[model samples]
Target: MTVPLLAITAWSGTGKTTLLQQVIPELNALGVRCGLIKHTHHEMEVDTPGKDSYLLRKAGADQVIVASDRRWALMCETPQQPLSLAELAARMDSSVLDLVLVEGFKGEPVPKIVLWRRGVKGGVEDLLDEHVIAVASDEPLQTGLPALDMRQPAQVAAFIARWRAAYR
Candidate 1:
């Protein structure tokens, strides 16, 4: 079976990453095996310069897998092409993960929990799409989606658990 996926989306500095950092551990304590995918707007280098994986990519290897005793990581060199969220999730080990939490790609066709902070410059309002399932914020939103308390981790986790249970 495919693992369920949920996108945590927000504009820059809206605290999506912070929220995820809090949520992931809490969910893990509840026995949820979670995987994360973070979307970047600029070029990102996981393999440092002068490293073996970095040198291999510099030498034109399309993909590089680095493994050690403790962990492993795969770096795929795709400069311009953007993979859909589904395509990216396929690269993950679905058998071991119960859920995949995406950190960006708000426009992707998946349920999203949006982080909204007052005085923020950008938000989901400009997206012109209906992918957002709920909003987590400090202030109230006029949109009809459920507004979750950003300070409450239990509430957020419960919301996710309840949603998953309904479908399961």
Candidate 2:
């Protein structure tokens, strides 16, 4: 079965990541195995220079995966090509996950929770698509979509749970 996917999107400083950091634990407590896919416009390095994994990648390994007792990480070289959300999701091990929480991809054609913080560079107005099913905002948003209090993680998690339940 295809795992359910939800994109949490907003402008910089809108607390999208912060909100997810709170909501994910609550969802885990409710027995939901959630996977995350975050998109970054800037270059990111998970491993430091001179590290074994870093050296492996530097040596031209297309995909370098390092696993330990505690955690495992994979560094795949995409070489400037932007992977679509669907393409990224396909790369994940979704068989054991109940939900996939995407941290960006605002333009993607997936259901999303748009985080709207006042005075931010972008607002809910930027998300004019019907795929945006909910809006989590510090202030009121002028839209018909369900407005969720940005400060309430439990409520947000509940909303996600309810939505997932309905789809199931």
Candidate 3:
């Protein structure tokens, strides 16, 4: 199976995650199985405080696996180094996913669809590069790249589907 990876990127308040909320379902309707990787700067916790797994982690356990009848979650504590996007994707269950949509990692050399909003710190000029396959924006841009309206999820999904086909 050919698993393709694409990225959605924009400034902090530009709704990268919000767009994925709609795009994932749209892609599903189009028969595309999706996985997502999100980048964050804050220190995040996957285990709830005061829980057994949390306690074990706080006591210096490097990794913890919590499993139940319905699901299983693996939390690894690595304060020294973080996993790269490729590293994280390698750990995904490849048998079920057809595409991996990455959010952020704007500087990484990857095929990315950038989102541009008016007065959102950076303009399309900053987003222009060979890896940027398209631009989804609230305002018209002159970057000569294919631009999609931000209000239309179905249209965006279609564009992604076409790209995914070519990518495959």
In candidate 3, what are the lDDT values of residues 10-98, reduced to their tens digit?
Answer: 88899998899999999999998899989998978878999999999899999899999999988887788898888888878879998
Which window of 10 residues has the lowest lDDT sum in candidate 1? Answer: 122-131
lDDT, candidate 1, 1-168, per-residue tens: 788888988888889888888888878877777899999999777899998789988999988889999999988877788788889999999989888999988778888888888778776486325777788888777778888988887778778766666646
The root-mean-square deviation over C-alpha atoms between each candidate and the true structure, in angstroms, is 1.8, 1.3, 1.3
Would you list the clashing residue pairs of candidate 1? Answer: none
After superposing candidate 1 on the true structure, give the runs of residues whose Cα lies further than 4 Å from its correct spot.
Answer: 127-129
Question: What TM value does model 1 have?
Answer: 0.91
Query: Which rank order by TM-score, best down to worst?
Result: 2, 3, 1
Evaluated at residue 109, the lDDT of candidate 1 is 85
Candidate 2 Cα errors over 4 Å, as ranges: none
lDDT of 2 by residue, 21-128 (tens): 999999998888899999888878888999988998999998998999998888889888867788889888977899999998888899999998888896568765
